[model samples]
Target: MTGFQNILTLYRENATTLLIVIVFIFTFSNNYICKILPLS
Candidate 1:
C-alpha cells in the first residue's frame, strides 16, 4: 500500500511537469509562427 501511494504521488508530479512543458511548447510555437508572418 505504501508503494502504491508513492507511485501515485510520483505520477501526479510528473503529470504537472508534462502539462507545463506542453503549455510552453504551445506558447513558443505560436509566437514563432506569428513573427514569421508579415502584418499590415
Candidate 2:
C-alpha cells in the first residue's frame, strides 16, 4: 500500500509538470507565430 501511494504521488507530480510544460509551449508558439505573421 505504501509503495502504491508513493507511485501515485509521483505520477501526479509528473503529470502536473507535464501539463505546465505543454501549456507553456503552446502559448509560446502561438505568440511567436503571431509575431512573424504580418498584420493587415
Candidate 3:
C-alpha cells in the first residue's frame, strides 16, 4: 500500500511534465515522420 501511494504521489507531482512529454512525442512523430518518410 505504501508503494502504491508513493507511486500515485509521484505521478501527481509530475503529471504536467508527463503530459508535455507525451504531447511532444506525438507531435514529433506526426510532423517529422510524415515529412521525412515516404509513407504518411
Candidate 4:
C-alpha cells in the first residue's frame, strides 16, 4: 500500500513538471512563428 502511494506521488510530480515544460515550449514556438510570419 505504501509503495503504491509513493509511486502515485512521484508520478504526479513528474506530470506537473512535464506540463510546465510543454506549456513553455508551446508559448515560445508560437511567438517565434508569429514573428517569422508577417501577420499584421
Candidate 5:
C-alpha cells in the first residue's frame, strides 16, 4: 500500500508537469505560426 501511494503521488506530479509543458509548447507553436502566416 505504501509503495502504491508513492507511485500515485509521483505520477500526479509528473502529469501536472507534462500538462504544463504541453500547454506551453502548444501556445508557443500557435504564436509562431500566426507570425509566419499573413493576416487576413
Candidate 6:
C-alpha cells in the first residue's frame, strides 16, 4: 500500500510538470509563429 501511494504521488508530480511544459511550448510556438507571419 505504501509503494502504491508513493507511485501515485510521483505520477501526480510528473503530470503537473508535463502540463506546464505543454503550456509553455504552445505559448512559445504561438508567439514565434505570430512574429513570422506578417499578414497577421
Model 6 residue 11 distance off true place after TM-score fit, in angstroms: 0.3
From the highest TM-score down, the ranking of the candidates is: 6, 2, 5, 1, 4, 3
Tens digits of lDDT, candidate 4, 1-40: 9999999999999999999999999999999999989965
Candidate 3, residue 13: Cα displacement in angstroms equals 3.5
Stretches off by above 4 angstroms in model 6 are none
Per residue, candidate 5 scores C-alpha lDDT tens digits across 1-40 of 9999999999999999999999999999999999889864
Question: How well does model 1 score by local distance difference test?
Answer: 0.96
TM-score of every model?
0.88, 0.90, 0.53, 0.86, 0.89, 0.91
Across residues 1-40, which tens digit of lDDT does each residue of candidate 6 receive?
9999999999999999999999999999999999989977
Cα deviation at 26, candidate 1, in Å, is 0.3
TM-score of 5: 0.89
> Candidate 2, TM-score vs. the true structure?
0.90
By summed lDDT, which 10 consecutive residues of candidate 3 come out lowest? 31-40
Alpha-carbon lDDT, every model: 0.96, 0.97, 0.91, 0.98, 0.97, 0.98
Model 6 residue 19 CA deviation (Å) reads: 0.2
Better of 4 and 6 by TM-score: 6
Off by over 4 Å in 2: none
**Candidate 3's residue-wise lDDT over 1-40, tens digit each?**
9999999999987997899999999998899888888864
What lDDT would candidate 4 get against the real structure? Answer: 0.98
Clashing pairs in 6: none
Best by TM-score: 6
Over the stretch 1-40, how does candidate 2's per-residue lDDT look in tens digits?
9999999999999999999999999999999889888863
What's the C-alpha lDDT at position 13 in model 4?
100
